[model samples]
Target: MERTVYEEETYVGLVVRESKISVNSSLEQDDNQLDFDLKIIAENTGDMLIIASYSNNTMGENEAVNESVDISNLFKANIAFRYFNGMVFSCSVYDFYDQMPLEAKIEFTMTKRISSSVTNKDKWEMFCVFLDETRSTWSDAGMVTTSYSLDQVSCYSEHLTSFSVLMKVTTDNVSVENSETLSLMSTVCV
Candidate 1:
């Protein structure tokens, strides 16, 4: 999620929260190289989030967004979890010809905030979770979090659904970026 990157960035943009009535940025066919790499975080939950992007070549088109949602009252929130973040993803990709969502590989990275106590590696207990549509429940995304780097934890994603990168916390105070402030344009790398 830093400015420095070493991969071929096929599609990169503002990660937004996906809902029933969806509006997302579509990755297009292009030959030019976009030279920007980005990283963002969840405001309230204190979870620093990063995105690892890819191009779904077999797919005619795919829809996704990195969105953050903050609630004023956790007592009334729908998700019954001890830890949850605004870093949610809507991963509904359509077949170029069939209009169905296909399973694909995705990943997330979290950078350690140097000055913040919450980001302390010793005190943090974090995990990634995805929402199950039929049961309306949040379950573990079954992804692996590896601290291969000294300052980041990247998790692997394997399916199409809504995803959240969460962290355990003892306080209710948190901040999230407003949806209106985000731009959906994507960045590609050479």
Candidate 2:
């Protein structure tokens, strides 16, 4: 039994420009019926369109997210990001009812701008957290408390310089409806 050929794991460089940024349900449905999507594959020239992934979907029918709505009249929660040079990383969602429950806390922070020539090489920094809550206004209530936490950073051959990586993503107790929409999407590769 001698016939073996194994060669897997290939990433050949040079991805010039690939762009896609979205916030849906027709761009927040005139201020409600919310839906959001943000995708900007790559742009080697760099000015922050390097995000290859970002998704948050909560459209309709899939209700079962316990009851804890009323995120303080639900308005004023924007988490923005645009780095690479154009520089624009944002944050908001200030204590949304303290994140719900008796000691709830859902705070999504942002500020990630790392381009010291790929933080020194062999690079991979990924942070993805997406949770679409529902209950359709508590019709059958029993689920909405969403939770998320994931962080991965690796930059081998160290010699890093350019930095600004403080991307905190947190979530707890998410029962949304009343024009439900809590969205965020981020997938970047530079």
Q: Pick the candidate with the highest TM-score.
A: 1
Instruction: For candidate 2, write residues 1-190 as lDDT tens digits.
Output: 1111222222111111221221111111111111112232222222221111111223211221223222222232331121212111111111112232111112222222334433232222222222223423311112121222222221111111111112221132443332134343222321
Deviation from native of the Cα of residue 152 in model 1, angstroms: 4.3
TM-score of each: 0.39, 0.15
Displacement of residue 31 (Cα, Å) in model 1 is 28
What is the Cα-based lDDT of residue 137 in candidate 2?
A: 31
lDDT of 1 by residue, 9-56 (tens): 444343333221222132221331111122211122222222223232
RMSD of 2: 23.3
Error of model 2, residue 102, in angstroms: 33
RMSD of each: 18.8, 23.3
Q: Local distance difference test, per candidate? A: 0.36, 0.21
